[model samples]
Target: MSFRNLAAAFALTCVAVPALAQTPAPATTAHSASDMGLKMADTATVKLKFVTVKPADITSSKLIGTNVYNNNKETVGEIEDLVIENGKTVTGVIVSVGGFLGLGERYVVLDPSTISVSNKDNKWAAYVDTDKDTLNKAPTFDYSKKK
Candidate 1:
């Protein structure tokens, strides 16, 4: 009722008003199933059919040590490691090229689609369309630097 009291109350209200205004509003649904005419299922209940390869067809361990050859049937490199994307798809293969008995070896990354596999003389062989010289010229990949 007093002027001093009224002034004090007005100051307090001014400070309180901004804080209240700054408070975040409750989240609202941006989209609804009825709006799209499609019922949404829980992500946990959703089943995604991911692509898969048979274990008998090719195993990781078998591929690791497999020697890669060129069209000339000359050994170009050995598959040192496989680059997997999203922990499922095989994206690339790291081949150790231009080295003798693992000494001074340089690693080259090649896409999995670029390589082919064959069974000949009772042995499974991996082949690439590139030659040894071409693969040797590719930029080297350092496995030790991977984070």
Candidate 2:
């Protein structure tokens, strides 16, 4: 072949190689059953227990005992009582923050709206929306007639 033709072919091949290099490779398989076997997917099926309740629902519906914890998971308080409106609107929950063996525990009242309800797959946590000063000055409740 002529030198000019050979050189032209080489230049074309070089340009083609770079263009091909700039192209992305085809995608490979991204997921498999084993990779996500234990992960909770949006489409996964779950069986759950159900119940029905009315005004009495507020009393009959089973609720988890409130467990107040310190930053280190130390048990600081337990919900002794909750004050709810007649319509089941929880106004506030009394948290027993401190005491030695249930003796002189100081009850702290927090707004029920601060609590976050959680399930097995999810979690509920309380966010004290009130400022530190407000929470500190919240009225204490009498444990005798609490939640």
Candidate 3:
């Protein structure tokens, strides 16, 4: 009985001693947006204004990638992107010109008012008053240098 009791005590010591001796893993920390070096903008700082869209109002989805044409119905460029200032006004429209299958493509920023868009027969088209040659020779807009 004494030997049996000693053996039981030995078993408990062998199991508990190793467990007590082992160091616990470090606590996992929950990372917030700030911790990852991202500064989140406060939505409360921006005043929200509700806007009502009319049926004639064009959506961005329909405007972007729309083929641009001249008054002669010649293809001048394609609308690539839009530049918005203060999240309110669209300042410029980015048009890709002089590209052959996107190989020699160059971007040009045009005034929003200069380009007119129309949706006739469910086909969206943008018209600019410039020719294809003029747009191809215009000053290029480099996307890599955008701040």
Q: Each prediction's Cα lDDT score? A: 0.62, 0.44, 0.65
Output the lDDT of residue 65, model 1. 66
User: Largest TM-score belongs to which candidate?
Assistant: 3
For residues 18-104, write the lDDT of model 2, one tens digit per residue: 232322323873533343212245774533322332222222112324465444444556655555443223456667655578776
| Candidate 3 clashes between residue pairs 3 or more apart in a chain or in different chains | none
Error of 3 at 124 (Å): 0.4
**Model 1 pairs whose backbones collide:** none
Rank candidates, lDDT, best first: 3, 1, 2
Query: lDDT, candidate 1, residue 31?
Result: 34
Please list the residue runs of candidate 1 whose C-alpha ends up more than 4 Å from where it truly belongs after superposition.
Answer: 1-56, 145-147
Candidate 3 local distance difference test against the native: 0.65
* Best candidate according to lDDT: 3
Off by over 4 Å in 2: 1-64, 70-72, 119-138, 145-147
lDDT score of residue 13 within candidate 2: 29
Cα TM-score of candidate 3: 0.66
Clash count for each candidate, listed in order shown: 0, 4, 0
Q: Give the true-structure RMSD of model 1.
A: 24.1
Which portions of model 3 miss their true places by more than 4 Å? 1-40, 46-49, 144-147
